[model samples]
Target: MAVGLLFLVCAGAVLYSAEAQDPYSELPDYYKRGVDLALEQLNSHAGVHHHFRFLRSLDKSDIESGFGVRYLYHHFYLKPTRCAKGTTESNPQTCPFRNDRPLMDCAVCYKAAEDQIEPSPKPYVHCIQKPRLTQDMRTARTDHCKKMTYNSGAPTLLAVSTG
Candidate 1:
């Protein structure tokens, strides 16, 4: 009985120690408080009423710059909800028309290859999804790739950079 009790205590201590290593907890108290306030404000002001959980924060670093301002980025995602009428197809353009506030923008990336290349194969397609913003231009670029690649005399079957 003593041995079992001691094992349980050791296990509990290990678990506690593992959880105590939170990186967020190491952040400054003021920064943590600011994050909390920002989350609260977003939840309150957003049209949808749901728990907005913190996703992460990122900083954009430029290589050709000196010790400039260090920008911190934060992101959040909404908890799953029962209001699943048409949330999957929500976008900025269609959301307003459907009288719904979009939770996020939908971004799509496509990849394609030529049809007759024996080694390259045919009907090569790929897709990626990203959050869309007001400035995103959703232009179909299949023809653009074909034209651009045709001039270089090389296989233009790859993912094109968007910038």
Candidate 2:
């Protein structure tokens, strides 16, 4: 009986570790978010409450759900500007982002959109603009990111930019 219990414990540990270490599980948080967006779109049944909360968030409160979809937040320019490359810029286009950590970059990104940043003290990114993006602009902007992430393996706007 004791061996059976011990075997169960060991089996559980192996399963848990395997789940944690699965190569498919290695994608960053924003990648997971992109997947969630696709899943959310596919599920179409996750309901409006969360979507409303995200849309209504004066600050994008629920975006943190991006378990591996971090890359979605990166902003690109048709032309690179003087923004420094190694620190968090209140604006990625006009400022700098410290590449020390991708999450830090994500935080800085939230600051610019200011639409979504988990309500927090000392949040890394701070919005300097009133987020003038209209609903159309926001949709366009988000779609840009989503497209890039969803079709990362395919040619993208950035690719067009560079091409």
Candidate 3:
């Protein structure tokens, strides 16, 4: 029975770690706009059938490049939404997340300066698709997509650790 107890302890620790890794949900609008800009670039380049929504930020940093120029670096997660790509509905917030699709780990960096031109240079964005979602990601999806339900027709996928 000691082995069984140890297994339970280990499982609890793993769950806690996942929860602890989640970033803050209450971010300022300035940071959220950064996420939107990243999404715009990501959706444009991605070949995926569905558009991805910003799930949560993993980390962020603001560094002054020079002479009043600030560089914003954002690392975040993106989850596939029910809305199809190139749809007339421009708002990803209205679309529900698809549990069947893979989660995306993404990072974007861009210059933010008050004197910058109207159309700032495209942010440098890179993303990798993770085959499975972490516990924290699932929790975030649930909270973020609370306004809509998951697609019933899509097959429910399980989250397996790649590690």
Q: Whose lDDT is greatest here?
A: 3
lDDT of 3 by residue, 43-154 (tens): 7775767877778877665544456655455667888888888882854466777998778887555556653411454455566686554667645543332322123442
- List TM-score per model, in order: 0.30, 0.22, 0.54
> Considering only N, C-alpha and C atoms within 3 Å, which residue pairs clash in candidate 1?
105-132
lDDT (tens digit, per residue) of candidate 2 on 62-94: 232234322224321111123422332553333
Better of 1 and 2 by TM-score: 1
CA lDDT scores, all candidates in order: 0.32, 0.31, 0.60
Q: Give the residue spans of candidate 3 off by over 4 A.
A: 1-26, 64-68, 88-90, 115-122, 131-163
Q: Give the higher-lDDT candidate: 1 or 3.
A: 3
Name the Cα RMSD for model 1.
16.6
How many pairs of residues collide in each model?
A: 1, 21, 0
Indicate which candidate wins on TM-score.
3
Cα miss at 4, model 1 (Å)? 5.3
True lDDT of residue 8, candidate 1: 100
Count: clashes, candidate 2: 21
Question: At residue 109, what lDDT does model 1 achieve?
Answer: 15
